[model samples]
Structure formats: C-alpha cells, structure tokens
Target chain A: MHRSYYTLIASLPHLPLHFELDRTPITRPRLNERLKLLEDADRDVIDQMSAFLVWDRQPLDRNDQEVIERYDNLMRTVSNPLVRALINTRINMRTIVSAVRRRKAGGSPPVGVGQWVDHIRRNWEHPEFRLAGRYAWIRPFQNLIDEGAAREAQRLLFSVNYRTWSRMAEHYAFSFEGLILYLARWEIIDRWTSQDANAGQQRFEKLISETLGEHANLY
Target chain B: MDESLLMILGWTGIYGATALGAVGSIIGCSRAGQAACGAMLDVESGYGRLVGLSALPSSQIIYGIVVTMTLRGNPLTAQSAPGLFAVGVLCGIALLFSAAFQGACCASAIHASKNKPEVFGLSAAPAAIVEGFAVFAFIFALVVAGGIPQ
Candidate 1:
C-alpha cells in the first residue's frame, strides 16, 4: 500500500506541448478548458481568479481587495513548497505595489501583506525568509519600488520566480514534485505572456539557457 | 569426513550458489520490470529502452552460474570438498547482494527516465556500475577455484 501511494504521488498528469496559449485575450470558456489540465490544488487557485472581477458594491469594495483575499487563501492552502514560494514572491510584489500606491495617497499599509512585508524588512536574512524564494531578489525588488517602476518590478519578480522554478527542476528532476510545479507555473505564465508569443518564446529560451548554464557549474 | 559426505558437501556448494543466483535474478528483474511498466504510462515511445535496462540485474545470475560450474571438479575428494563449499557459498552471497542492489538502481533509473526520457542512458550508469561488482566476484571465484586441489 505504501509503495502504491508513492507511485500515485510520482505519476504526474500529461501536459501536451500544443497547449494553444496563442489565443490572446483568452475567453472564459477557453481559460476554463485549459485549466482542466491542472491538478486540483493548482486548479482551485486559477478558478478563483474570476472572483477578482467584482464590479458590484458588496462585501468587497474593490477588485484589488478581492484579489488580495484570494491570494491569502492560495498562500494558506497550496501544498507544493515550490508553488508556495512562487506565490509568496508574487504576494511580495503585490505588497510593494500596494505600499507605493498607499504612500501616494497618504494612507497606511494594508493588512496581511503589509505585516508580512514588515516582517521581511526586519528579518530579510533569516532562514525562514528564504522560504518565499525572495531572499535573492528582495533588495533588487526594493530598488525597483524606490525608482517608482512598479511595472518593471513586477516583471523582475516574474523572472526571479521563473529562475526559482528552473532551479527546483534541476535539483529535483528525479521527483514528480518539481515537474508538476514547473508545468503549473508555466501554465500561469503562458496565460500572462500569451499576448506576444514571439517575445514570450525568446524570454523563455533566455531563462532556460541561463539556468542550464548555472547548473553546469554545480554538477 | 567420509567420501560420500564430502561429495554431498561439494555438490551442495555448487547447487547453493546456483540457487542464490536464481533468487537474486528474480528480485532484480521483478523490481526493474515493475518500474518499467509504471514508466510506460508517461511516455509516448521508448518503452523498449526501459524494458531493456531492466534486464541489467540478470547478469548477476550469469556470474553465479559461472562460479557454480567452476567449483565443480572431477572426483569431489575430501581434500577439495571444503574449498568448493567455501568458494561456492561466498561467491553466491556476493552475487545475491550485487543483483539485489543493482535492481534497486535500475528501478530508480526507470522512474527518473519516465519524466525525462532524454536521461534514460545517463540514469542507467549507476546500475551498470553495480553490475561491475558482480563481475568482480565472478572473476575472483574462478581464480580461487583454480587454486583448489582436485
């Protein structure tokens, strides 16, 4: 029984190369269909993304607030450590954006994210701070934030997260955990970057080259 | 000991080695085969490579058979009976473990290659290294058998 359970955990779902991400401005039906390929843990996160588009005045006053709540739910429940790290990096990116926006409005820091941002500020070198895969890029992200380049900071965060995924894939290639996490992360990025396939492909190739070159030195 | 007892002991040595080799092969093949079957679920092609790689542990049995044959001499006299028993049993024990561990290596290779088929050849390197130990035992047994008095 134990052996069977191990096999089940190691058996990842098939992800075809022809994922058809080129359909920019992906319609709801197309997005849902593509999402069916993900494991339950990842699917839940993407499925709840629609809740971010709350135009009506209800329990959530702003779409951004809904997004933050969804992110908190995702961070709390995600099973994969690699995925959790990537999610934390994204959350930190959001916090930076929020911090800049709040400062412009002469308001205070937001709730959960603001507290975590404060924690990172105090203990950036702590081992626990490394859990988010942000330790390597935190100062750079802060620099971008200081420059008022939120868009550039977001792009930098995404690239850093991509590097983390690459490193995990290299270190844990024998296990299914890395493969599943990588494919899921790639799917999310594919959605975001599908607007320009040529540029996306170039960026992906550059990331892969750089990652493999780095691994060559270690092994 | 009597001639009959000595003969029995000599024969036991040979048979014991053969039996242990069979046990090792069974274990090695079963483990590797199971991993190959599991790996087939993920890939589109290259099922043959995994199945072929799974057969690597069977070499241990070949080594065991050679050692068993080497221990068999004309006229199992009292003088040579103890030497036969020693060589057969020792080589059998070595081959048994070598094959078992080789099987584990092959299983890991199969599983690893399932996700990244490109690494199939590279992954088999560890299992091949394990088989080399069996070869060493095989050669030493043959050399030691020659030293036994007929």
Candidate 2:
C-alpha cells in the first residue's frame, strides 16, 4: 500500500554529503514545488515531520519543558513507524548533545526531562554516558567537546547524521521512505552550510566593529 | 472427461495466452513507463531512449499473440486439447513473468542512466536478458504447438 513517488524522487537533484558540500544543491522553494506532487495525506505527514525536525519550525526560545512537551505531542500524533524512528533518532542525538553541554557546564544530571533523562542520570559520571559501545562516535565527539572545539563537534554531529541517513536511504530506493531520507540528508546539508555562512558573517562583523572602534579612538 | 468440456478448456488456454500476456505487459509497461516519465523530468534530451526502454515490456504482448496463433492452429480434439492447454498456459505465464521483470530492469536502467548517461547501454543489459527469456518461451511454445495433433 506504500505509494512510490518515482517522478518526485527523480526530479530531486543528488545531494552531496554534508561535509563535502559548500551549499545546498536545491533551494527550499524548488524543493517545495517538487513536493507538491505528494498526496494530501503524505503532505500532512511531511508537515508533521517538519514540525519535529526542521530547525525554524519551532521557536528557539522555548524552555526544556516546552520542547519536551512538543516532542511528546509529535510522538503521540505521528503514527508512521519510519517517521517515528526518525524522530526518535533525532531526539536521542539532541539528548546526547544536551547531556554533553550540561556536563561541560558542571551541572548534575537533568530531571523532569523524560525517559532519556534516566540514561543521562545513570551514566552522568562516565565520559560517554556509557554509550561509547553503541555510539562509537561519542568518544571522539566527547573529546571534541572537552577540548572546546565547538565547530569541530558540530561537524562531527553533522557527519554522523549524514552517514546514518545515507545508510537508511540504501534500503528505500524509489519509495516514500527514500524520499524522506533524501529530505533528511538535505536538511542536514542545508543546516551545515547556513551555519558556516553565519560564522563567516559574524567574523566579518567583528573585524569591522574593531576597525570602527579604532577609528573612534583616533578621533 | 467430456470432449466438449476439453474443447472449452482448450479455448480458455488459447485466449488465456493473449489475455495473460496482455495483463503482464500492461503492468510491466505501466511500471517502466512511470519511471521513464520521471527520468524525462530530470534530464533534457534522450527522451526518445527513455520512452523506447519503457516500451520494452510491450514485446510480451506480441509474444502472447504469436503463442495464441500457434495454439489456435491446433484442432481442439481431446488428444490435442490437453497439449494446447498446457503449452498455452505455461507459455503465457513465462511471458508474463519475463515481461514484468524486464520492466523492472528497464526502470532501474532509466533511473541509473538519468544520473549517469554513460551507463545507459550497460544498464539495459539486464532488460535484454529478460527479453531473451520471453523469446525462449515464445519459441518453445511454437515448436511444441506444431507437434500437437492438428
């Protein structure tokens, strides 16, 4: 009963690996145009998926409780096993990253967060939350975190997501699952490219402000 | 059992050859044609080749017609009826599967070729092999139908 979108998938340009790309291959508007081919129900699923995964869909200023409630609502509403798995993986990754940041800030294991908090609480003392066996990248990622290499840690996270989605994509060629995986990978690449651009812009602004300050001192 | 019943079954076989083959061709061509249409949207030019590949499964219908004709030439006697039924149904099934699988192969080829045009020829190799199997079924049905009592 799963519908295959041969035309939609074919129309999409091949997305390069996140680290390899300097920019996204397709723009959001063009991608949206292609997505118009999806059935209404599938479009609803996509909207739900974006609500859960897309960065800008949720406000950045929400508290931990609000974010957790949103996640709980998404888990309750989205019935597709594949979409659920994707959402779970994304949340787990976020949980791990959040744990790392909290530990770096010298905070104790968080409370009232949800089920994932238990793992963080249990393994608060361990460097990789004892998840090194399951997540091989965690040890290196933790190392990057501890060394204060924020950009490198970000890149490592992007790489892990890119590789995971790429492997998932192999099993779902020419199907709706394949299209979802493609979109996930595209989102990662888009996020990374935007982040890099933002960083460059910030650096430029900082240099300009310093020059302006120096001129003011001379006056 | 009854001669008339056997004759009716033989008729079913004759019609089933073309009918089943047409059904298979319909499904196969639909699948591959959708892929070809998709590929056409991705790439400019080379549209002819994609459309051509999509038509590869349509050959099974022709093979079915040939098999139908061969079976029809045999007179419906109790002696020949069973042979016609066996040859017709089996040949139809063989053509059905081959054409369906060939369509899948063609679709895959179109997808690959759309991305990397250099592999277009090589990618069609699998579909051609499937067509070869359809040809075998067609030939065998004809040879066997000729041996059936006219």
Candidate No. with top DockQ: 2
Q: What pairs collide in candidate 1?
A: none
Once superposed on the true structure, which residue ranges of model 1 sit more than 4 Å away at CA? A1-118, A121-134, A143-155, A169-219, B1-35, B38-46, B68-126, B145-150
Interface RMSD over true interface Cα atoms for each candidate: 3.8, 1.6
What digit string (tens of lDDT, one per residue) describes model 2 on residues B73-128? 87888888888888888889998898888888888888888888999999999999
Note the residue pairs that clash in candidate 2: none
lDDT of 1 by residue, B1-150 (tens): 678988888887777788788789888887787667656655678889888988888988888787787676535788888888888888888888888878878878887777777898899999989888888888988888889888
| Per-prediction DockQ | 0.11, 0.42
Per-residue lDDT of candidate 1, residues A1-219 (tens digit):
012212322233333233334433334454455445456655554443333212111222245566567776765666555556555655665655454455445655544353376764454444334434635565566567678886566566556655556566555532445444445445545544654558778767778778798673564
Candidate 2 lDDT, A1-219, residue by residue in tens: 699876788677776644446567788888988899999999888888877776533433346786678777887899877888888877777777777777888976654344567987898998888888878888888899889898898789879989998998979867898888888888888777777876557657677778797673464
Per-candidate local distance difference test: 0.63, 0.82
Write down the TM-score for model 2: 0.86
What's the TM-score of every candidate structure? 0.51, 0.86
Off by over 4 Å in 2: A17-19, A55-62, A111-116, A198-219, B1-5, B147-150
